[model samples]
Target: MTGRLFGQGEVGSSDLIREAAKRAGAKLLEYELDAQFRCSGSDGFINWVDNTLDIRRTANVLWKREDVYEFRVMDSVQELEHAIRQKAAEGSARLVAGFCWPWSNPNGDGSLVKDVQVGTWAMPWNAKPDAGHLGAGIPKSNFWASDPGGLEQVGCVYTAQGFEFDYVGIIFGPDLRYDWEKNIWVGDKKHSFDSVVKKSGDRFVDLVKNTYRVLFTRGIKGCYVHFMDEGTRKFFQSRLE
Candidate 1:
């Protein structure tokens, strides 16, 4: 599969996607975000004519925050599988887990590092379609028959909102806080600056607590968790105990 990996600022996600695609032999469908970007994630080839195609399926990777589109197209199942595997290998694979059952073996802790597919949230445990967490039918990927291997799982507090997992590894990205004095979440803010700044705004305490609760409860069997900051990590350690 191939497309113009469009994104403002630095190109981490787009670059990773492109490299992974190239490694897998998927062609890059190039088009400016401002221009009409298009592609089909199937084995059948897509012929882009200024912005037209003769394929059965086609989609646009339009971004919300930025006015950009990553024109991508896939050719074969083999290419799709390779691309997914490559995408999965985008980030760290260290299983950021919670304190629970299936993930009980501490020995397996470092096994998933190296290439982690950024799960629902920036965290790993929030990984979707996990053992028990996946709702019903598996999410349809552009390619491959199953979730690619090698990618790590990072469970986030929010995305794990109402779900459960048989075994979970939660990685607390730089996105949470706990008020030690009040025994509550200092505030609940997603990947926003308001979350880090004190007076930037009031912390969504209830939301934070509830979010953590959901993330913690996901482990029907086992869990392991990693916090991004020492402060949050200390808090999680105390709570886990």
Candidate 2:
């Protein structure tokens, strides 16, 4: 228990952990996750960009109290997927990723995380499209079990934690949205079918924020989001602008 437990400050919802670490005399080091071209996940490859990385800021940078990332907000899912396809066809897709379930909320149009291709498994889970919370679709499995080099299939938090990629396409659904009148993000458990999220209740908002926080930070280079809720999309767009 006394041993230091280190974590990435950029993604983890570990404020308490970091505070405790500071009390324990640990020095926190910051690194920039700014999207840049890289060949491999190996330190040797990452080292090649270290000079550039050291001078940059994180892709998900916090300005004031809002989180910001240099990104392209696609007008539609089709347009978003097209961008994904381009990254893939260019060989850079080796580390490009897609996120969220085909259906983020049941009440809304049941959408799938389009794989942007056919005939090959973009990720390990692509081989099993019919696996998930319900035994019939993409399984809500752990990222550790995933094929490290895989990139085609969409990855949820469970399959993406503690991992970083060159690029990620986030499909933000209606389950989490913004209330302009209230000026606060609200979490609707009923909209989410995920067992863990549905049961969060009072803690739902925190969980939702962390969920997206974890997802958004998965990309070391950049992220593009297709928000299902126009309100939320507009809210984010306003901030980015």
Candidate 3:
């Protein structure tokens, strides 16, 4: 897998974490870098008639499960920042999960976000802020803000539903769902985008498309996309025209 450049001093995505925090100008409720593993195996194990066991080439099941070092609660913002900074710089990417107060997307551009190399980008499922005057459906998530300083420092979008950023820098990891047809995000089996769709219907789909749209549009003037599905690229090309 291709590695993403993140953080300060080639260490952690914390440079990004700090920048984002600064941009939002919000305090940290909590945050940390959590470790996880990408595991998969054959679902059905078949026995051979020859007194030996043969593993059939059945469907492959892949999923991310929490690995060693379960959870490390962060006390201060600096500690959380330092931990992520350290992880982003490591040779292998480690999973990190944490909580943050809430921020509003002031800009909402996709090109502005940067991709991280070492870890999956995740935020608190409940951190979503109220969409005050921005009006509903306009995308009031903090990920949609355009902070010139923040953009130059750390670029990427890593969060959940109901958010839009001026520059979305999604860190592609093993969990991403690939759709060869639409060439867009199919759905994360782990995160269960399908369930989100089922629960919210078109409203959910619209939020996803719009969330990605906001992510794609984050560029200062244009979008720089990498490793996208053919269908997704086509969708972008068609829409850009």
Candidate 4:
């Protein structure tokens, strides 16, 4: 398990398993799985994400593997969505975002409400609970990651986790940003839409960071991203440069 990639308010189960074995007087055997299965098997891309997010310090301070694994930052969310749509034509692709928008239920007519809005661009969150009579091609929330109709909506971390796509489009929300003056990543609960994560007190920042770390690493072949915060976008761009 990638311990550092744990989601908001999540506690690793590895320790619990080890403790249970000790109490039962049984030896616990552990093996580290380091082989890369995601990001086109580019471990360097993963390391670069870890270092870039300040999740851990690693030798990969710069990402120079665009030829092997596609990574691009778009100036606008419109471009991000367009790119993802183009990739989806070739293979699997989905757009995901931080939990920074309230997920409203489907409209009375069974159409999803456009809740994820960025400037002039807007898209609905994946189907909500008991979303009855969805339009012809829209998939239910559970199948959003695998279904072709999923491209019509935006996926949150809850639905996107444990799912890998050939191409991923990520919207970096305002819940977390890089504070240029302080030289640190700041988590602002006021900008967060997740109630549980926002109330994490001192751990809010780490949880928010982990949430993005998970979102950013969901692509197997490429990741296209648009940041809601300019400072955060610049910070990531600087690392690539």
Candidate 5:
């Protein structure tokens, strides 16, 4: 019974997952946060779970290069931005909102991306992420749980794997989308900075989708997504309709 039913990468699919988990009587879980924004769970804690732009385009600092793993810039997405902000700022729930993808390494000098943090450093960058963001495998850092409203830090399947949250907001990057003509999810290696995921060749799309799926299901109360690719967003919209 414990397996993945990862639906298509649609927009509200995470919401559906949350609903289904609730129906199943899944216990809601949250991270333990300290004043410094560091977060963790009580011993033996275990559960499975579940963006915006401008402020996002300006704030999302985690990247691989100028173009390789950059955030998709758009004209307007502040509502999505505000929802995340509201969850972190007002909701009593311990929330974490972030991006998902196959790449996001530290700058060349083993330093977190500066100027990206709206204020100070937090999750996604709090833990000393890998220096190059080029690890062949998924990142092993779990910093998202620690971030407050640090939009710059984005967590993928790698960081979100064994944890659950009260509410989770996700940024679905451009690495994966559907080919309307071909009728299959497509993984654009060009959009991926992780050499391993890019090198997956035939498995690239599956890996990407699964990565986002992990991100989507990392919340017990709710899940939200802001897709970077218009095509992917449209595909999701169609599915939701």
Candidate 6:
């Protein structure tokens, strides 16, 4: 089954597939997999996420299984990093962020530039695809989620997708923010680093929402997050309260 919640850039493949089948005069069958294998097998957690993100309304608005699956919001980027690192010692863990910063290439000395900066806190994005020779412990874009050294760098939606970790730390960037006055989520393309997604025009907001949905559900055991936007953070906190 395909999940539109995880769709990025343009429309998801399921839509295209359905359209093609209709045009070819072929009847298509679809099935819904209601069972939850991710987020500690808590279908409630998934529903909670959908409701929380304003993606759709679901029965599980507030998460009920705190003991079974962990979900936390951190005060700062530093706190998010520390929590993820601590979890990494016990099991697989990775830090991921929204496409809010430029992914810079390594220096001539094979040193990574800290492009993701929030206040005084800064960290480099995962190694570039052509990062021929990374410094001692850094992993290339593909292995960022699985490698031990991945903790040192921040990952974006591209590298973090299709991977599962025991725990995940996410930096909720300014690209997507909740408008308190209007009671809506606003997507600012100016704050987004993903040029391809920004080119999606009006669809950018939904894609950005889906990107976070993917990030939020990456952890099987737990997920921690740091929000750059205070109003947006408070909006999320209100849903739980």
The digit string of per-residue lDDT tens for model 6 on 77-171 reads: 88999999999999999999999998888987888999999999999999977678788888877778778888899888887887789999999
TM-score of each: 0.33, 0.53, 0.27, 0.84, 0.52, 0.84
TM-score of predicted model 1? 0.33
lDDT of 5 by residue, 19-127 (tens): 8779999975544443211113311111111111111122222221232211222222344446656666654222222223224356554445432122232334333
lDDT of each: 0.34, 0.49, 0.30, 0.87, 0.46, 0.86
lDDT of 1 at 31: 47
Number of backbone clashes in candidate 1: 40
RMSD, model 1, all Cα superposed?
18.8
Q: Which stretches of candidate 2 lie over 4 Å from their true place?
A: 1-69, 91-152
**Tens-digit per-residue lDDT, 75-113, candidate 3:** 332344455445434421211211111232332432212
Model 1 misplaced stretches (Cα beyond 4 Å): 1-163, 179-184, 188-190, 193-203, 239-241
When 4 and 5 are scored with TM-score, the better candidate is 4
Alpha-carbon error at 81 in model 5, in Å? 3.1
Global lDDT for candidate 1? 0.34
lDDT of 5 at 83: 64
Worst lDDT 10-window in candidate 5: 43-52
Error of 5 at 142 (Å): 4.1
Candidate 2 least-lDDT 10 residues = 48-57
- For candidate 2, the TM-score is 0.53
Residue 70 deviation, candidate 6, in Å? 0.7
For model 1, how does the per-residue alpha-carbon lDDT over 87-161 read when each residue is reduced to its tens digit?
Answer: 335521213222221221112432222222223222123222323223222221111112332122333332333
Clashes of 5: 8
Cα displacement (angstroms), candidate 1, residue 147, comes to 3.8
